[model samples]
Target: MSLLVVGSVAYDGIETPFGKVDKILGGSATYISLTSSYFQKNVNLVGVVGKDFSQDDIDLFKSKDIDLQGLQMDESGNTFFWKGKYHYDLNNRDTLDTQLNVFEHFNPKIPESYRDAKFIALGNIEPSLQAKVLEQVNSPDLVVMDTMNFWIEGTLDALKQTLKNVDLLVINDSEARELADEPNLIKSADLIRKMGPDFLIIKKGEHGALLFTDDEIFSAPAYPIVDIFDPTGAGDSFMGGLLGWLSYTNDLSPQNFRRAVIFGSVMASFCVEEFGPDRLRDLTEKEIYDRYREFRELSEIPEVG
Candidate 1:
């Protein structure tokens, strides 16, 4: 099975209590593709970069065995650049600067080879663009889309239109509450399910993640980490891990979905251990599975038999 990811690939300048980096390999698609590459062999990436995006960065994706046929390069423009600083607690962050540049014109064109991708992941981008991706792909088995509050508020019509085609909707708790206009998550999930997707994943950051369907709800706790250096790209990494495992197994059962969320948390926990995708770049299957085991043990509440 193959997976296709459509999102931004750009440069990021990050600052945290640990240290600061002027520019590094970063973007929703970059993190998602890197994390997903660990679980699946064929990961087709679709995004745009500019002349300023270095060849070394392009090589980075190739090194991960990520297919870049759909990756576009705009020689005349600069790559999207974002500068952000994280709070000491690592829960909240402030965006210092954002330059959309080439990404502003990113119109994803799925390569002919990727048109039949079994699984498609639409990273946090405009809902119209996410809908456009679905228009190009041939009957994907699973369609997962991630969004933020920006689109939920500014483009509700387009967001809801895109939702109709998505199999799973992944968004954080705040976005969920705002989207459904309900304070209660369970109620919010119910309202969201009516909008489109059969499944909804409400990410609660370090608190954990929740998965809800029409008939069932599954909760996955976040892996505990004493030191979280940077929280950037954690959510995308989570999505990558979740979709990567599911794409590898080609299983959509609720039980399997529950496991996928745990694996996602596992990957996300590792993401915050270092800045950008440095930690995930060199991760091995053994390490991922070992963490998965820890997650299982942590959540396992044995019955008093």
Candidate 2:
């Protein structure tokens, strides 16, 4: 199953209680594609970067064997850049600066070779842009889209329209609430499902993530780690691990979705242990498998008669 990921690929400056980085490789597509690559090969990436994009980063993508055919290079200006500082709780952040640069005028021109992707992961971006990506690709087996409060507050209508075509919607709990205009998660998920997306995932940050379907709901628990270096890109990494597993197994059963949720949690747990995607890179297959088993153990109390 071919996996196509579309979103921003840019430089990020992050300041957290644990550590800080002035500039590093970071973006929704960057994290999603890299994390997914561990599970699926030939992961296709579509995003724009300026001449400032580093060769090491390019090599990093190639190291994972991620396909970069859809990546665009605009030498006219710098790539998208964002700087933020996280509070002690690591839940809230203050945006210090944002430079869209080439990403501002980004036009997702899917390559002819990538038009037939099997699984599509749309990262957090403008709703209209996400829809444009959908329009360019052929019918994919599964379409997963991630959105944020920004789009919910600004482009609710367009977001809703795009959701109509998406199979799954991945958003934080607050964004889910904001999008559905409901307080309770269960009811909010129902309202959101009615808009579109047979499946809805509400990411609850450190609390874990919830998966909602037409009739079933699965709650995945978070991995406990004392030291969390950076929370940025954790959600995208979860998407990567999730869609990556789905594409790798080509399984869409409700039961399989449960496993995918756990894998998503596993990847997210690793993500916060290091800055950017440092933890995601250099991960061994055995490490992932072992951690997955450990995740299972977290709630696998022996069946009590």
Task: Please list the C-alpha lDDT of all candidates, in the order they appear.
Answer: 0.93, 0.93
Q: After superposition, how far is residue 230 of candidate 2 from its true place, in Å?
A: 0.5
What lDDT does model 1 reach? Answer: 0.93
Candidate 2: misplaced stretches above 4 Å? Answer: none
Per-candidate TM equals 0.98, 0.99
Clashes of each: 0, 0
lDDT for each residue of candidate 1 in 109-148, tens digit (9 for 90 to 100): 9999999999999999999999999999998999999999
Total backbone clashes of model 2? 0
lDDT assessment of candidate 2: 0.93
Off by over 4 Å in 1: none
